[model samples]
Structures are given as C-alpha cells and as structure tokens.
Target: MQESQSLLATARSKLEKSLLAKGLRRSGERFAILEEVYSRNDHFDAEELFQAMHQRSYPVSRATVYNTLDVLVDCGLVRRHHFGEEDNSKSRYEKSLGRQQHAHLVCTVCHRVKEFCDPRLHLIQTNVGNALQFEVESHSLVFYGQCTDDACETKPTDSSANTEDSRKTQE
Candidate 1:
C-alpha cells in the first residue's frame, strides 16, 4: 500500500509538470481520473474508465475520460495496448509509472489479459540489438491463445486435441 501511494504521488507530480509544460489547466477532474487509474490493477478501455468514475460518485463526461487518457498516454503515465487482431479498434490502457516492462498473454476466448516478466526476453532484446547494431529502447510482445480457466466462456471440449490443433496452426 505504501509503495502504491508513493507511485501515485510520483505519477501526480509527473502529470502536473506535463500539464504545465503543455499549457493545460490543472483541473480537479484530471487529477481524479489519474487517481482512479492508479488505483486499478487491470487494463481498461476509456468507456470502462468513464463508467468507473461515475461508479465512484465522481461524474465526468466520456469526452473528459477519453481526452484525459490521451493526455496520460502522451505524458508516459499510461501504456496503451492493442492486444489482438480481432479487437484492433479497442485499445486498453494501464498505468506505466514505476512498473517494469512486461509481456502480455491474451485469452482469445475470454479476452482476458495476463502480464508476465521474463529476464530472458530482456536478454534476447539486448542480444538482438547488439547483433543488429541498433539501439532497442523498448519492446512489446503479446501471446494470444485460449485460456484454460474453467470460467472461460469458450472452453475446448478435448484439451489434448485443442492443444494439438493450436500447435499445428502455429507450425
């Protein structure tokens, strides 16, 4: 909890500086949106964020939510992701401040997202950058497949067959 609070504080300061640099008004609505975003642990869309704000008794317009998200993304306070080809139009966002770089696993059936970090991935990035003589600042990797959770909306009738089929398709 203390760590989260400190992260939020740092994010607030960054947002303040960004807004000032852009000559934007330091409004309460923007701060409220930031606080709401930092309080969550899931990737969310702009509509979900707007609804969340209303649920928290802080009514703000959809436009405000969308515009604020754009500002946050620009200021590096938020990370936007387009997870799968099927949902190219829907963009999901997560707070980026004080968070380590990670990869995502997207459930094609349920559209659920899971995040993981692997040191090998970083090492591969470094090696590839060195080999290509290119500076790799960052990378985004997403693995898309059906999740095996019981609550998933669409579950394979035969897990073994499904796995085999997935492998064949990949190959």
Candidate 2:
C-alpha cells in the first residue's frame, strides 16, 4: 500500500508537470478527483464517488468527476468496467496504476468487486491479437458471481436489476 501511494503521488506530480508543459491550465478540481480515486481502496463508479465526495463536504460536481475520470482513463491511469451482458449500464471504475491486466469478479447480489490478476489471461490477449492479426486497443473482462453475504443469497432471482440513475451534476 505504501508503494501504491508513492507511485500515485509520483504519477500525479508528473501529470501536473505534463499539463504545464502542454500549455494547459492546471485544474484543482481535476487533481482532487484523481487524488480521491488514487487514495480509495475499493472500486467505485462515478455516481458512488459523487455521493461520497458530497458527504465529505468536497465541492466536486458529478460532471467534473466523470470528466476527470475520462482523462485518467485516456492517460492510462484508471480502469473502467462494464459488467455482464444483460446490463451495460452498470459501469464502474478504479485506478490502474501499478496494477496491470487484471480481471474482475463482481458479485451479482452485492456488486462487490474482487480483482484477479492472471498471467495466462495476459498471454491469451497477446496470442489472440497475433492470431487474429488485429491490433488490440483495449478490452474489458468481468466475471459475475454470488457474494458471501447472506442477505445477498436471499435476494429474489431475476428481479429488476440494480441500476445507477442519472448523476445530478451542474452543467
């Protein structure tokens, strides 16, 4: 965890310098969003992050969070997950620095995400790209399972899925 913190701090510092080099104005709000993500121990979606920040008295808008997350994703600093085939709407995100090519185990009941890093999976990615002769840009692999929670086990089967609603954000 200490190493992760140090890596994140270094990455943030370099990112700030890069922005300055590109003649772009540094954004305190964007830095705040990135810092929150890098500091979190659990995977969180944008809406979850918004609620958490609001509760903590952080002046962070939902759009700002989303936009900042988009920047991080583009810059290869975060990983985004859209789990399951039935619901593409349930999206989540996490920091990807120092954690490369990991799969997710998302509980269908509680939605708790567990990270899995398999080298064999990494090999497959490389092999598939070679065999298909297509350059792989990116991929998302998530496995859905039941949680250990007893309450989760008792939930009705095939009921209306838990959905993330429109994030309240100031345009």
Candidate 3:
C-alpha cells in the first residue's frame, strides 16, 4: 500500500480471486480498504478508517468499508471488537488470526488503549478445550485498569508490581 504498489496488486489479486470463487462482485474499493488495513500498524474503526481514507481521496464509502470488513472477517484476515455501546455502530478492527496471543489494557477514565502479546494463550486455549472436551474456537482477554500520569502498577498474581512500575516509566 505504501510502496511498489505490488503489495496492493498481490492483495487485490488474492481478494478478487477469493471473492470471485464465492460468486461475489469484487467492488473496486474493498481491495483498497483491505490493503490500507493490512499495510498499517494501527487498529481502526469504520468511521475512523472512512474519514482517514476520504481525507486521502481513496474513493471509499462507509458502506463499502463495513462490507469489506465483514468480508475480511469471513476470510479470517481481521478481528473485530465492540468497545462501547456508544461507539455509534463502529467496531474496532485489529490485524491478526493465528500465532498471535493478544491482550488489551483499557482505561475506563480516558478510554485509552494498549495491546500486548502473550505466548501462553495457546496453552490456555488447549487446556480449556481439553477440560471441557470442546474444541477452542477463539478467545479474547482484556484487562481494565485506571492509568495514572506517572506510574500505575497492578498485576494479577503477576507479582510484578515493581516490574510494572518500571514498564510504566516507558509510557
């Protein structure tokens, strides 16, 4: 999306091929939207993405954005989340599916977001599935805490209060 346009070409080819196989129209803007999302490092909501794309004159519509996102979800290319009831029907989208253990930290005070990766999630999923004899489909874990300007340290048996204090300084 940023450079040699080949990235866009490859992504478009894959998306179009996938969509065509399902007998769906490969409407023009969806590929652009997917390329933008895949090439970026930030999480986004529909309106946020639409505004940003419109500012860049990407020829995108809100409906197409949402539709493309649904397609991405179906294709296992993106994950969606509902952060709040007041989110105006816009869901947060993140980039990932496999080999990724993700957790989020939220500030109810300011609604700030933070993400982390933990490898132990796979083991947890496996154990949970084994315990229930139900195959683990997918899982999400989010931890909420009040974040202070200076340092806020809270751990969940996770007796890393001191370690957390050190990490907060980086923020």
Candidate 4:
C-alpha cells in the first residue's frame, strides 16, 4: 500500500508539473481523474473510466473525463493505444509515466493486451528507420495472435470477419 501511494504521489507531482508548464489550471476533477487512472495498472477505455468514477460518486462529467484525457495525452502524462481496429475500435489508455518503452502482444480472440520489452525490437526500429531515411520518433509494435487459453484456441478464425470488422471501423 505504501508503495502504491508513493507511486501515485510521484505521478501526481509529474502531472502537476506538466499541467503548470502548459499553463493549465489544476482542479479536483482533474486530480480525481488522474488518481483513478493511477489506481488501475492496465489499459482502459474512456467509458470504463467514466463508469468507475460515477460508480464511486466522484461527480465528474463525461466531457471532463474526455477533455482531461486529451490534456493528459498532450502533456505526455498518458499514452493512448489502438490495439487492432483502425478507428480506435479498441482504443485504450495506459499510464506512461515511469514506464519503459515496450511493445504489445494482442490476443485477437480475447482482446487481451500484454506488454513486453526487447532491445532487439528497438534496434530493429532504428535500423528500419535509418534504412528508410526517416527519423523514428516513436513506435507502436503489436503482434496479434491467439492465446493458449482454451477459449482462444477454440475461437474460430475468419479472415472475412476481420475484413468486415476493418470496414466497419473505417466507417
């Protein structure tokens, strides 16, 4: 518990600095939202955060959560990810503060996201960018595959369905 609290405090301090640097005012709503985010150690969507706040009777608006999310992302306090679908179909946010750069392993069957770190991947990115004559600012590497879970193994794999899902995401 003490470690968690310490981490939260550190995150709050970083957020405070970022907000002040951007000339943004600090408020209870924004702090509460940030606290809620730190409470979770996994990826989550905006609706999930909104529901959690309302369930706790925090008295935050949907717009406030969304707008604060934008600010947090802009200030580099949070990281937004689109796991599979194009139009953020599985869009999620994860706290990036104090977290090292890593790649993701996404389970297509269960939509589970796993984080992994590898030096070779970083080197590959650098080599690819250098070869292509482009400076790589950052990268999001996601490998999609079925998990070893029974459900995932039993799930049907259909290419047409994936195509349809992609089309729907585009729309």
Candidate 2 structure quality by residue, lDDT tens digits, 43-125: 88899888877777888878888877777776677777777635678667888777677778888766677888888887888
**Model 1, span 1-171: residue lDDT tens:** 999999999999999999999999999999999999999999999999999999999999999999999999999999999986575898999999988989999998788899999999999999999999999988999999989898876665688678889999999
Candidate 3 lDDT over residue span 1-171, tens digit each: 344266555556777777988888887687778867776666778888888788778977788888888887777667887665356475788765332567787765565667887779878889989999998888888777666644333322335666788799989
Worst 10 residues of 2 by lDDT: 162-171
TM-score of each: 0.89, 0.73, 0.73, 0.76
Worst 10 residues of 4 by lDDT: 148-157
What is the per-residue lDDT of model 4 for residues 1-171, given as tens digits with 9 covering 90 to 100?
897788789878887898899888899999999999988889888999999999999989889999898887887778999886545665699988777889888887777778899999889989999999999988888899977766565465678679889999999
Ranking by lDDT: 1, 4, 2, 3
Report residue 61 deviation for candidate 4 (angstroms).
1.1
lDDT assessment of candidate 3: 0.73
User: What's the true lDDT of residue 108 in model 2?
Assistant: 71
| Candidate 2 similarity to native, TM-score | 0.73
Number of clashing pairs per prediction, in order:
0, 0, 0, 0
lDDT of 3 at 68: 88
Candidate 2, lDDT over the whole model = 0.75
- List the candidate 1 regions with Cα displacement exceeding 4 Å: 156-171
Model 2 CA deviation exceeding 4 Å by range: 17-24, 85-87, 134-138, 148-171
- Which has the better lDDT: candidate 1, or candidate 2? 1
Model 4: lDDT to the true structure: 0.86
**Candidate 3 ranges beyond 4 A from true positions:** 1-14, 97-99, 149-171
